[model samples]
Target: MILVTGATGNIGRSLVGRLAGAGAEVRALTRSAGRATVPAGVGVVEGDLDDPGSLRPALTGVEAIFLLRTGDTDTSQILKTAAEAGIARVVTVSSLLAQTHPDSSVGRTLLRGEQVVRDSGLEWTILRPWEFFSNLLFWAPAIRSDGVVRAPRPGLPSPAIDPRDIASVAASALLEDGHGGKTYPLTGPATLTPQEKIAAISAALGRPLRFEEDPSLATEDPADDLAAAVSFPGVCAVASPGALSTVEDVTGVPATAFRQWAIEHADSFR
Candidate 1:
């Protein structure tokens, strides 16, 4: 059986469905089982990653795990518990920033989690994905209200990955062998500037949209902060040189393009 932490999140939600769709015994761990909605035939167990002791019930019968780092969670202890529970494999979702911008706060946190998993003695695969296309959802409100996206860097480009692609890679690593001890850096098929992304959304929504470069835009919301962080100029460049092939190489499917993702999720901007 495979246990998925952060089961309700963007990547974890897709990961659970992908595993179950493949006929794997899947269990989803959530802080509140009452609130989590998972695929049929999947088990839901209430647990808190922040408190490692709360994970025991969820860990029962789990042979492999998809570990997603949550805020300040004690990863070392979690891995210790998983090892003690006899879970033999772990697939973790980290960020490319851990490799590209190691000095950054987010990079440091993710690197620490990766180290813990490596030290756990379990068969492990780490996924370091670039900015998620879902981060564009941060502009939903502004787009809905005025069809305008205002951000600091309009020309900066990112090969922003789809979270589903990240989940697909994780599923392969968890369910297949030959992936242990490997770290995969993942990205979308093409790099796109904010203007280009807005154009894609506009075409998807069948309407025009605007991109405004506002250097003074303040990021108060966590979502906005994340979107802004990924827009940083050098973060994507460092990771994108050869990382774009990882999704296709690992999953036998090409990495998703931002325009396609934008089309699929156009309702959010509408």
Candidate 2:
């Protein structure tokens, strides 16, 4: 059995669906069993990753595990539990910043998690992805009301990836061989600035939306909680050169482009 944590989340939901469709005997961990939406033939177990004891039921009979970094949890305990459970393969969804900026607290936390996975003596694969294109949701309301997108870091270009792309890479690592001990940096085909994304949304929506760039919304600013989720100076993989190629190498396919993602999610602007 393959166990997935954060199964209700954006990437997790996509991954769980795909893995189930591919005929994998999958189990998912959820904070509330009532909230998980796993497909038929899959098992749903209730557990909080922060509490190692809660994970035992989900870990039972599971051959591999997909872990999300739950900050403040005892990672060493989690690894030990997985190892003891005889779960041989572990795939972790790590941040690009973990490798780009190892000194920051957030980066260090991810690095520490990776170490725990490595020390557990189990086969492991880590995926480090750039900014997510789904972040465009932050502009949904602004666009819906006035056809304007208020984007942060309007000048910084990012090869932001789609969450489904991340899921594809995850499923590849879990169901296939040749990925153990490897760290892949996943990203989209084209690099785009925030304004360019706004234009793409406008084109996709068949509307004349405008880009209202906001400079005060730096990821470092305290009021921007959303940016904080993806922020860490000098740590994100978007600035790295070889990230896009790495995704193709591991997945045996090219990652989706930002424009395709925007087109598929265009209804949000309506």
TM-score of predicted structure 2 = 0.89
Task: Report the C-alpha lDDT of model 2 over 55-112, residue by residue, as the tens digit.
Answer: 9988999999988877677877887898889899999888777876677776787788
Per-candidate Cα lDDT values, in order, are 0.84, 0.79
lDDT by residue (tens digit), candidate 1, 1-270: 999998999999999999999999999998889999998999999988889998988898889999998778888899999988999999998878788767767768778889888999999999998878888888899899999777655445678889999999999999999999999999888887778888899999999898887667644443444445655432222324433789999999999888898889998887
Clashing pairs in 1: none
Most lDDT-accurate candidate:
1
Residue clash pairs of candidate 2 = 97-235, 101-235
lDDT for 201 (candidate 1):
91
Query: Candidate 2: where is the Cα deviation over 4 Å?
Result: 151-153, 216-243
